[model samples]
Target: MAARNWKKGSFTGLHGLESALGLFYTRHMFRLAHFSDIHLGPLPAISYRELASKRITGYINWQRNRRLNLDHGIIDRITDDMLAAAPHHIALTGDLVNLALREEIERARLWLESLGPGEKVSVVPGNHDAYVPGALARCRRAWADYMTGDDGRAPTGRTAFPYLRVRDRVALIGVSSARATAPFMASGHFSKAQAKRLGALLDRTAAGGLFRVVMIHHPPVRGATHAAKRLYGIGRFQKIIRKHGAELILHGHTHKPTVHRIEGQNGMSVPVVGVAAAGQALGSAKPPAHYNLFEIEGEPGAWQIRFSRRGITDPHGEIGEVSGALLSPGK
Candidate 1:
């Protein structure tokens, strides 16, 4: 990820403050656990037909490098830690599978079920999820329950992107950037049509005085990823944020922990955060497996957020908080 050029608010150890404030806001606090980029492995057997196109390159890459670096056991540990924290809701950004194989999709669905029910969790797809022309349709069919909005309809057909799910005082908005690309290319696309819908959703949610959180698989800011894996139409996405604003934005794709700020309404700078891959092993070249817990409280226009980054930081394979910060809204 590139260095952030805009001003960023400082992060503090707000856990102490949270302890003090808990007396009054315990019931109001919404704990949201976010993790992404599973790329679940032990890739199932593939027929010659399965490896006909993009799968061939992905298969070769996984067998050569990904299988060794990504450990399902580490993912299990992370999930255990996340569950122990007892977040009110869990948000998974994307890349739940590698090759988007039929078996991989099915296995990922089971993994999702283990986390919790559809009402307690939300998801968005990544480039790998839609690795081929038909892979995304398969994922939609298998994981529709997880991606459906609060209205109880699965995200299917044309009105898919920018689905809405309201939980308590927060409005969780999911947008898809997942799409199939040429071999050796790992890119995502956010259409203008999605942006138009997102703008409307943001407006409606904002009017309801709910804490709006936008979830996407790829980072929406510029220079966040390599050209080969960038999110096209990011400008349109940013335009939506600039106009209607959101309380926070969560994403995963660069496979690294990053914080960037996007200009929001009335000069408010919304926090755009990305977590390291949940399946990445400790001591790997990239940041180790990790998850983020966000503590949000307070009503509209007076929100307080505390962010804690937890992950395996040692050789013992134990997961702990790597960093903490007090995030001020509109900073």
Candidate 2:
């Protein structure tokens, strides 16, 4: 444990004068399981292709003709394994449904509720959570039932971004970038109001002398391989984070694993992590789906983020390491 001052109360316009519970002075180190894109639903079909029927690869096409059942048991199994690891916290980045059905949202709630107590699990709404246009509100309402608070609205006025988990020496800040848009377009965007509020919150949380984690459903940086039409307001989003000294940013809209480096508000390199969807099975061209386990260690303002994967244990399973800028704390 390092000897340092852990100040309670707000020191800035963000959380100034606010009372905060302090943990005994010690090194804050814990493991976090970051998983996203569960797409849990009343998803009853041989495949997602039959419902809305999107263009799938030739392999999935063959699999669909085979009439295999879409067993979501895999999701439950993965969740069980992740919880069994006893991570300090679980960060789910959203898209827990195939479509935004009321039943789907309800089912997602039940799934999240079954995870554990609210404090141990933190979730952010993804684009699919908004079943219909402006469904984010509904998604927020549904998940609030699982969290401990007043209607799940954060002081920032966004229900998805509320509730700072002040456990150990880490403050996990949750955000929502999920929105309903026209068909054929799947992307996420952070409103100007939300971005500003997030910056203020990050500033206050960082000043509190705890490791600051910013969680969202969309990638903060533009993905090189992402379609231009599907890109979110990631540029402006990253600008706010860089300006606010966010150490770790977690997201999971893109199914494939993505990690990027963006300049932080404090001139430091912030690591933006994107976890693959733990829900989707290997359709055709891709490997089996998996989740991420991140172990962070070090003193305040200086920590190392180590990333690993779980789910597929087969000798030839599609598990690998996250190297380069993504593996290191500072890109």
Candidate 3:
């Protein structure tokens, strides 16, 4: 693909992507697919014990509206479309289950296997995955393979907050912002300790001349969500980015396709992108389910990123590329 001449602008038609496919086939580019918020259902039956905690509110919400708003079939379609694109690796930011129930967690494991092997996919937890105090522990055990780092454990070998997996030329760093919160709230927390470890990882990856891609569940950008749903310690997260640069940042809490920029080293700007929920049904209040394909090429300092957003755009349930752009690193 002669992407060198393609200026940073919106892709006007399918022709641009169609023509580039020929060149993409010949070149060895690193293609990464990112999607989140699966919220798989029909939420397995829950008992009174499960409903005694915050799950009570979530269970009510799922019954009243989420059941209709989320469709597992839509997620199936999205995954099929993404796999057809043939990305080298997949990053799932989180919320694979609805209420973090044991059955739901186990079901999510099967769904992950269908996508690809653990080596080809990386994952991080979301607020819903940690809906209650003990839910996250169960998720850790169930999804251990996908969440483990290159060393076969979390980065610290003690906590699972920050994990690293280096693919070809890209380093996938998984961070968790998922935590249990009070009723009527859906916020996430990022502790100073995790931020410290993240900074070191970014530095180490950058030194190794690897393209660093930080994957987290909640958007690190301020004001990205409502007050009750915002990520706590977002400032600390931003501080790390401003000090140590990263090529890209992927997140998925907002359940809306969004693009935000955070300041990076030497005044460069890092792209913080979020995709809509993978299970969002057509005609739902939010945008239909979508996933992002990022083609990363070139070397460490002169890297190039071409990203396309694909998902259901009509009531027919057909998936298509909604938008795309040739992104510049420091823009």
Candidate 4:
């Protein structure tokens, strides 16, 4: 099976391919599993010097609040289920650490490795990953490949925002909204430069008939989060999508499952979805840890995407489907 030769007057991945010398042809179906805000815990020991800056606040927050809500036991169960289901690809939106500490970032990388190789997994930093001024540099050094665009075309080894990855009939656009904020603040932002570049890339990618999915850390819709932790440029982000158009948007940060509708082209509505923290323990304050499994099957124009939201409800519980929705309406 030469796998459909792309060299012939050939075809785009948009079409079904015949393999084994044309004995059979199968339409391609892409399955993507999405989860975010892992906040892998058991934070490293802190020092007085380390707490000299913004980290002191984060350190205290983790010790008092986050550590109790985040449970690795729950996370382990969810990860086991994800691996068992084995989607074709996985996207992690961020918060893979507690304090953006070097040890935390490196540990998160190792956890990502256990999930799969860089090709199978994608990551975008969360606010916690950028909790301090220079922490992003360390994250860039550690998780460069996961953040790289398809074909290694993204800007250097640094974690460049809004890189593009084209797979099958889908274009996964990775964007960074993670930013270091003052103590008691958890927010995200997208620069004007990044917005311009993203608009161009969205137009180009959508022209190729790929289902554009915007990967971001914070929800782009207005009123999606508390004022202190919201995405700074919600209006700008909405304008870009309304102008350029994306079929779907995925984000993390709220740790609550949500499906917000936004305007798309020609009166159609685009779906912006947010998943609860993948490692959070079951509690009254927030939704339980869950990951979304999207079943994407169809050709370029007649695509169908179905969502299955799965979660781990308790420490001794097994993962199960919590709900389902048609990501693409009218079909």
Candidate 5:
């Protein structure tokens, strides 16, 4: 009996050591599929009653302007191609619906279900997701599962902002910048409370040696979008980053593909990336509908992000590789 117990203890110790070595010596690789600004169309028929508020302007704009610019079929094609690539996890930045109507919010929930389970996909909201006063509240309840962290803990009061989800070696931090704006405005904001919490989250996580990826709807940098749609408290975000730093930042709202770098701790250049509208047509003034596939390799602080930009070409309607690049953030 004594010999058997000794053998069991030895085996357990060896197993723990083996797991530690596996994490240190070998690079854990995974593909992250990112796409945003769906802006799903064929809006549910609005009632003359429903069109009384700010929704009226949005409805008219959708019917006259957006209908020609965006296409649901294009989104289908883009998603088909994205699924074929077989990503480990998917990150959907926001704007699933344009008007944030009850019908649209429910439809967006269905659309999220079609993408994959809530566990496999992480979503954040866009300005369009919270287009009206109560629309944001409606959206949060519907997408609560997708928006919350995987920590399995219930919130004390309001659902907290800047939640964290860990997958393997990656830590995906979700930030909410979506806010209801007045007519003709598309701005986004992050409150001081969220900013303070975010700094603590980043500092503690970065110290623990996990690759931190920030998922927010609005870009956290100046000149990234028009003044009307710009993300406020960008300075606050940058300050936090300069002190603690994140490995990557992903956002969507501009319906444009953009790549940028912001200051990071120890003088590293953190990559801030954005994708074009996932449901936008091929040649609608905006970039073609597309998705970003990031192939992450190596360990935290020494990681390499290889990105493949897949997109559709206008007039031809052919899906092809739009661009590819090797990203060494903080290098």
Candidate 6:
């Protein structure tokens, strides 16, 4: 039960979360789990063939890629373990598919469905989820019974962006940064309207004392190494965070386990955390398929984030804690 040694104010490039932490106000406490890049099974060989036939598939060279590491049993086990920890809620960033295949999307839905019911799980779509014209909508349709009941009804027809999942003490702000890239670009961009809407949503939610946890597919900031500088419009995303405060930011595009502090305009540091791929066989020091468990406590407006690493088995295994963040404290 010992906590992992965490620096008081540190930022992980989980997503380019740059919130300026001004005065040190009282800290709120909350716990939740974060995982990303599921890349569910029954992958399309055609997509691989298509990638192979072509020189490249956006930023990734799939021709050289060897495998799709989404193990169903492993994922299920991890979910079971995380649930045993009894987190407040779960946040899935994106990349829930190897390709936007119908079967894959259906399988993904089943997988998420097997998890806790509506009040327990929140998810967003990644580029692969929305690669096709209406791929995202299809996935949403399949999971509608299991996921939140947004009903895909927005003022606009685009259900791809600005989805909400509200639990007991947390509100998951699911944003769609998934966009089909043209050959060499693997980056994503949220349209001006989407960004504006997201900012406004955060503002409203924050004012209402909701713990807003923003989830997206791409990294909001640059990678630890400059090798992946293809960061698109991350600066704008950071500005949105500054405009509105968030408790924790979670993402999984880069697949590297990193933690960072986003500085809010108010000079308060916001904690952004990332998890390595929960997909099977990622070839990392830790298990190829691992998920993060957060121990959250506190009332609405005030919550804390404590990070824990969980493997496929050993649900209650104490891997250790990383860092914690305070959102809004209930008066």
What lDDT does the true structure give each of the candidates?
0.90, 0.66, 0.89, 0.82, 0.84, 0.63
lDDT (0-100) at residue 166 of candidate 1? 91
lDDT of 6 at 240: 82
In candidate 2, what residue range of length 10 has the lowest lDDT sum?
Answer: 53-62
Model 3 earns a TM-score of 0.90
RMSD (CA, angstroms), candidate 5: 6.6
Candidate ranking under TM-score, highest first, comes to 1, 3, 5, 4, 2, 6
Q: What global local distance difference test value does model 5 have?
A: 0.84
| Model 5, span 1-331: residue lDDT tens | 0011122223457766765555323346778899999998788877888788788888889988898898788888898898888888899988999899898999989988988887788888899998988888788888877887877542222446788888777788888899889888889998888888889889888888888899999999899988989999999889888888899999999888899999988999999999999988865788888899998877766888999889885577777789999987875
With candidate 5 superimposed using the best TM-score fit, by how many Å does residue 121's alpha carbon deviate from the native?
0.4
lDDT of candidate 4 over 57-100, digit per residue (tens): 88878778888888788888888898888688899998889888
Q: If both were scored by TM-score, which would come out higher, candidate 1 or candidate 2? A: 1
Model 1 per-residue lDDT tens digits across residues 1-331: 0112321223225645544454222337788999999998889989999999999999999988899899889999999999999888999999999999999999999999999998889999999999999989899889998899877777776578789999888899999999999998988889988999999999999999999999999999999999999999989889889999999999999999999999998888999999999989866689999999999887888899999999997888889999999875675
TM-score of candidate 1 against the unseen true structure: 0.91
Residue pairs clashing, model 4: none
Off by over 4 Å in 2: 1-26, 41-71, 145-163, 228-231, 315-328
lDDT of candidate model 3 versus the reference? 0.89
Count of backbone clashes for each model? 0, 12, 0, 0, 0, 36
User: How many Å off is the CA of 129 in candidate 4?
Assistant: 0.3
lDDT of 3 by residue, 150-200 (tens): 978742233666999998878999999988899889899999999999999
TM-score of each: 0.91, 0.77, 0.90, 0.89, 0.90, 0.73
lDDT of 2 at 123: 84
